[model samples]
Target: MASGADPKFEAELRRGVVQLVALDYLETPRYGYDLVRLLGAAGFPVEEGTLYPILRRFEKQGILSSRWDTEGARPRKYYELSAEGRAQKNAMLGAWAQVRDATDEALKRSMEAGQVGSPDGAEEETTS
Candidate 1:
């Protein structure tokens, strides 16, 4: 929290993963609340405020479809990944894998090289 880089990167990473993880789980029909709990259990916490809007947008965009389950004590809107969503998720998965692999390689190179530059993005001096 103290480091500026930590918060920025964490926000970016979580924002990137939200759609991936949500679609992965929504491969089956699930209500939004159920999804929030499941995502939290999976170690990727998503607040309802943050998730509901995404779900609504995806629904409107036809990336996913939703139906109401009125048979239960309370009505719940269930969402499922659409065929288009499946294709989108596949593409996102492929892109994510590439990014992850690149990040891992960068970490490997960082470990081999030690720190490449200063924390503020300044290049370290080299002596000839």
Candidate 2:
């Protein structure tokens, strides 16, 4: 919570993993509170507020769809990843692979050069 620091670092990390988490849970319909509990139990570390917003954003992005089920004591909105969400998850997986491989290579080179490892590892790769 320092100035110039990313206040939502935790939220951003959760956001990055949301697609994968939602995909994993979409095997069965889940209500918002259930999703939050499951994600916490699974160690993704998200608050209910953060999870709900992300769910709504994903739905808006065409990555998910939902409906209310009134069979419970109160109506519950259930959500599932859309076809587009599945595709996006697949593509994100590929991008994750590329990033992982590139970081590993850069770390190896940095070790060879006696440079301490840093986050992202490949600052040079960020430009051109």
Candidate 3:
């Protein structure tokens, strides 16, 4: 983002990517704080509030599971992908790859043709 990037668009973009990024990071068990720090460092900043709800939703949906790890100073709930989660992750990643490739091709065609406003890569017709 440069000096004048649209915040609304940026927020929407981040929202779209959050699930994929969160799932990717949950490849290993991580506590709430750990996940927040890691995601922030990885450029997907998330609040504990935001993260907890998603974690709960994913748990209910059976894509993730959590357990208390009491080995530390305090008991921390750690979350990791379930068997179903792993499969979903792989499927999501694959679908993402297809989307990225398709978007790249569209952009390439746009750049080559130097047109805008539609997928047909044509300039709009003028009205009388």
Q: Output the number of the lDDT-best candidate.
A: 1
**What ranking emerges by lDDT with the best candidate at the front?**
1, 3, 2
Per-residue alpha-carbon lDDT of candidate 2 for residues 1-128, written as tens digits (9 for 90 to 100): 23454757755655777657666687578988888888877867667876777788888998888999999899999998788988887888788789779999997877765544344555433334
Residue 22 lDDT in model 3?
90
Clash tally, candidates in order: 0, 0, 0
Worst 10 residues of 1 by lDDT: 116-125
TM-score for predicted model 1 compared with the true structure = 0.84
lDDT of 3 by residue, 19-108 (tens): 889998999998888989988888788788888888899899999999998998999999999999999989988988998899999988
What TM-score goes with each of the models? 0.84, 0.71, 0.82
Candidate 3: stretches off by over 4 Å: 1-4, 115-128
CA lDDT, every model vs. true structure: 0.88, 0.76, 0.84
**lDDT for model 2:** 0.76
Misplaced by over 4 Å in model 2 are 1-14, 115-128
**lDDT of prediction 1:** 0.88
Q: How far is candidate 2 from the true structure (C-alpha RMSD, Å)?
A: 6.6
